[model samples]
Target: MALPTFTQRYEAGDAWLANSCAHPTLVQDVWAADMLAPIPSGEEWLVAEARLATGYPKLVRIRAEQRGPVLADPVMDALWWLVPLGAAEELADVRQLVVQAAGWCLNCPPTGWQVEGRMWITRPDGSGLLTDPAVLAAAFGPGGYRLATEASR
Candidate 1:
């Protein structure tokens, strides 16, 4: 269940501006370190898939059974979205679309991995956001953005 389209997702409130007011300063800080890069002109911007995930509930997990860079503390903050009624059940579907779309944008095949108690059933290599509701649900827990290193198994 890939997202119908970026347009469709946004229209349905699934597209949150990467730097919108809805995101807290902490979230922005985390996003900056974990998911954004600077354009040639020196302006910073969230990666394409990250931009998409901002509006939609998504996750981005790096798998390969190896940890890469050390994520800065502020960069690991969690951003949680409220799930309105009738939308809770669609978590898996939303995640699938987000994952597929991200994989396409990143020019890679979908890769699945487990994290904590939940599973990052779909993911990419470099940096991208997963859009499934279930993934989001797990990622943004009571505290938010559980460290990949400390995420439950």
Candidate 2:
């Protein structure tokens, strides 16, 4: 079979949320503004779908099913009410905790998977402390693969 396109993943994730039949909240609206973006065509949609599939909520239950106990984050308890059974396996415990503690900072509704912190969004990749490639190289590492020495701080 052909590999599923990004829109397919996004639509799938969207269906998962829609199947839950939960109403969007004020927080969700704001978070959505910060968190979600239009699919921007096929490739972007696929990127988003992949992120959602591997992110906190998705990773949580998936870990629970394949690995063990879901770490149990308070935030997830709130978010879980909105998720469908189909995507339950992907949620990660720690990620839920982060979302619980910091997810609110998201400027948009939760739509796609994200791999960075809220600060990363507020500041963005090519601005503020993240402006310099060397700074990023040191903070995150070479080719964004390694962390830097203490002097960087």
Residue 63: error of model 1 in Å?
7.8
- Separately for all candidates shown, the number of backbone clashes (residues 3 or more apart, or on different chains) is 9, 26
* lDDT of residue 138 for candidate 2: 25
Candidate 2 whole-model C-alpha lDDT, 0 to 1:
0.26
lDDT of 2 by residue, 1-153 (tens): 997665665445444332222333443453455553211211111111122222333333221212211112233332111221222223332222221221122222233434223111111111111112222112222222232342376
lDDT of candidate 1 over 1-153, digit per residue (tens): 774554453322211222222333443353344443111110111112223334233234423232211111112232222222233345434432222211111111112212222211222223323233444445444444455675765
Q: Stretches of candidate 2 above 4 Å error?
A: 24-32, 35-111, 115-153
The lDDT values for all models are 0.29, 0.26
Clashing pairs in 1: 2-97, 15-55, 16-55, 58-130, 59-130, 94-132, 95-131, 95-132, 116-152
Model 2 error, position 125 (Å): 27
Model 1 vs truth, CA RMSD: 16.1
